[model samples]
Target: MGGIGIMIAFFAGILGSLSASDYSQYTYVFCAVLVLTMIGFWDDRKDMRASHKLIGQLFAFFLVVVLGDIRIESFYGFLGIYALPISVSYALSIFMLVGLTNAYNLIDGLDGLAGTLGAISCGFLGVWFMYAGYAVEGIICLGMLGSLMAFLIYNWHPAKVFMGDTGSLPIGCFIAVFALLFIRENGEMHPSAVYKFHAPITAGLSLMVICSYDTLRVFLRRIRRGKSPFTPDKSHVHHFLMRMGHGHDQVAMFLGAIKLLFLGMVIMCSGLNEHLMFPFVVGLTIAFGSLINVVTLKRMRAKVRKSPPISQRYPIKPTATIKSKSTWEDEPVLES
Candidate 1:
């Protein structure tokens, strides 16, 4: 429903030309999203192998680069690495694009989990773009958000159909592309109209931290365990919640809400006060740290509960072997 609604609205927006960038935005996202949707939808039904999916993603990424003219211009001062050579930026951009696609796909296990969170993230991003005066990127975010909102109609709790890899992969990739477009280049600042806040890149990262962090953590854990990172398992945060007695619906809601809460903190500070980026970051760090502590405590409690008590370790001996004596006494009486 949400997906359909967005599709309709995008078409309508294209027809009406609500914004100058709407046309280009719709066309670019439409083609890429359609291809991704088809590939993902098919993969969902028929189970496409990892190799095939990777190939498809590469094809999609190349298409965006060639047609949409998407490229990574800069890192926004995060790594102390500024202007990259053209070739390196191109390579890095594609990598980030594909990585985002898969990150969302991997996080799409529970109902309303991926779609809802994606909507929230994109909605925030879309508004930020509009506020920053990047109308094209803003429109892109809004269009995507609208589509995902429609998808959630069927994707919420007791989901009728999953978004599968088809939806997740493309959506993720497109978002990365959007992020690339939104970031400022080395020594090339955006126009004053585009941003009313401190830094664009930090805002982008904060918005996407949930998906990025989960993907990074899982990838590292898999590498450390000498396991294939592509292999699927019940290791996601949502899965942990499920194992810890959360119902599927509850898990989905919890993950989405947590993501929103983080973004909300960032927005409330950054948007309202306009100089609270530092405080926003600090607050997020504290929240995430506390979350980790809670999860650790739950695991410890579960482990302790599953173990046997000390009394069970040593069974008491029987008080007497009276059955044998009774049998002997009865036998003697019978004989007499």
Candidate 2:
């Protein structure tokens, strides 16, 4: 179901492009991703292994580099980093492309979670590009948004199908490219501009906060316990929520809501003091932590409800049959 929606969107975008006649820079983007999307679709049906998917991501990222000339322009003032050298840009971009692609793929555990969040993030980036006059980037973002919008028809509550790693990997790669372009456009303009209004990076980071942070947290926790970070477990936020009694649909909706709220708050706070972003990040972390505690309490309540009384665990046998001695002389208590 999700695959069909993506096909329809791809065709619609192609038709729109043909009608325009005047080819745009986004033509390369659409063409480059066209093959990758098919590969993902094929893998979705065939159940590709992790190594195969990793190789596919490498190939797709190379396509972006070779065809689209994709590169990371800046670090957005983090780590005292500014412009990246050519070699660094190439390396970093590849790593980011693969990382984000898999990060989103990992998060596609519930219905509507990955698809809805992808749409919201891309839609925001599209608008930001329009304001920044990056028309090509904006069009690419619109194309992505369209694809996700179509996917959501089957991805919503009571989902008929999952996006699988196939759909999610492409979605993640698409968003990463959009963010790179967004940063390149404004990051190349002026330091002040990059600092003042970095809606694209902020939006992208905000949307995938749960996925990214959880991934990192699990990695660290696993390393601390001498375990492989890649090992699967029921520790994911969605999994814990399920254990806490949230239906799959409810968990998906709750996660989507959290992403949107965080995204909105970040957008609203972009113009505020530099100190504000830190506090917002801290607050969100706390909120997520509290949510986990609530889920824990819910699980405790479920355990309590499921537990049987001591008598049920170990039945006490009837000791004897008795009668009132005064009422019936012949009816005496008989001990068992």
Candidate 3:
């Protein structure tokens, strides 16, 4: 229902001011979102296999990349690479779309987490797009921002409504598109442009650092444990926070602050080259994730140490009479 409301609001917003050519440009995006929304709605009602969901996501992303021509055409000079081969571009675009969509989906574990993060990301992108003179994309980003703000009203701690896969999938995919567009637009900006980013790729990634890093961390941990990467488990960052005694609201706010911090870092470092900024952002994210895990583990161990022994906590009581070997007399037998 939240996802449906977002789509309705987005479409209505676009229909108001966009011309024919603008509508044509976004037709593929609309179609792809519709496909993703349907797939997500279906999965919400009848959980789909991970592989099947991947296939569905691939098809929707293909529409946007191949037909809509909204793909990463370059690496923005990261590692001395600029233009990419067509095949490589298609593959990279699809991988990013799928990865980000699932990353956002995975972070929906806590109330208001996903919606709050989504709003922050979309709001930043919207402001960037408008400042950079991309009205259509700006509208798209703001449309998502508006819906998310509304959704968060009911999705805050003690949530009245959950997004489920129905909202997460499409919302994630849309944010992925915005990130891609941000990278492309930033790269194409004139060198003298006031808002142009020197590290376009890194800037784009900073928008989703938290959830993407969490997803990558969870997948690696699962694989290391000899389990499928998609295997369900309570090993997410949110779960760790919960174990550390943080309430849902605290966890959500803490993560949201971390996300804003990343955005601020990217903005402050906008003049840095991708080579330097990329590694800095990646290192910071890994450090934060590792710190969370270490703190959570220590807290758990401390908790165990503080707890009383189970046998002492639940003492056995004498329930029957038994003969003692030495005394040859009746003695009380204690049963646990």
Candidate topping TM-score: 3
Best-first order by lDDT = 3, 2, 1
TM-scores, all candidates, are 0.75, 0.78, 0.90
Each model's lDDT: 0.68, 0.70, 0.88
- Local accuracy of candidate 3 as per-residue lDDT tens digits, 153-195: 8889899888888889988998998899899988988878889
Give the worst 10-residue stretch by lDDT in candidate 3.
327-336
TM-score of 1: 0.75
Give the per-residue lDDT digits (tens) of candidate 1, residues 1-336: 233344455556545545554565546555776677667777867998888878877877877766676776665454565577878877887787787777887888888888877888788778877776667667667877877777778777888867667567767776776766655431255334334444555565565666776777677778889998776676766766776677777877777787777676655544433234645565675578458648856886987799788679777776644456768776654332
Q: Candidate 3: where are CA atoms >4 Å away?
A: 309-336
Model 3 global lDDT (CA atoms, 0 to 1): 0.88
In lDDT terms, which candidate is top? 3
lDDT at residue 29 of model 3 (Cα atoms): 81
- TM-score for candidate 2, residues paired by index: 0.78
Candidate 3 residue 45 Cα shift, in angstroms, is 0.7
Model 2, runs deviating above 4 Å: 17-24, 190-204, 222-226, 272-283, 286-294, 301-306, 309-336
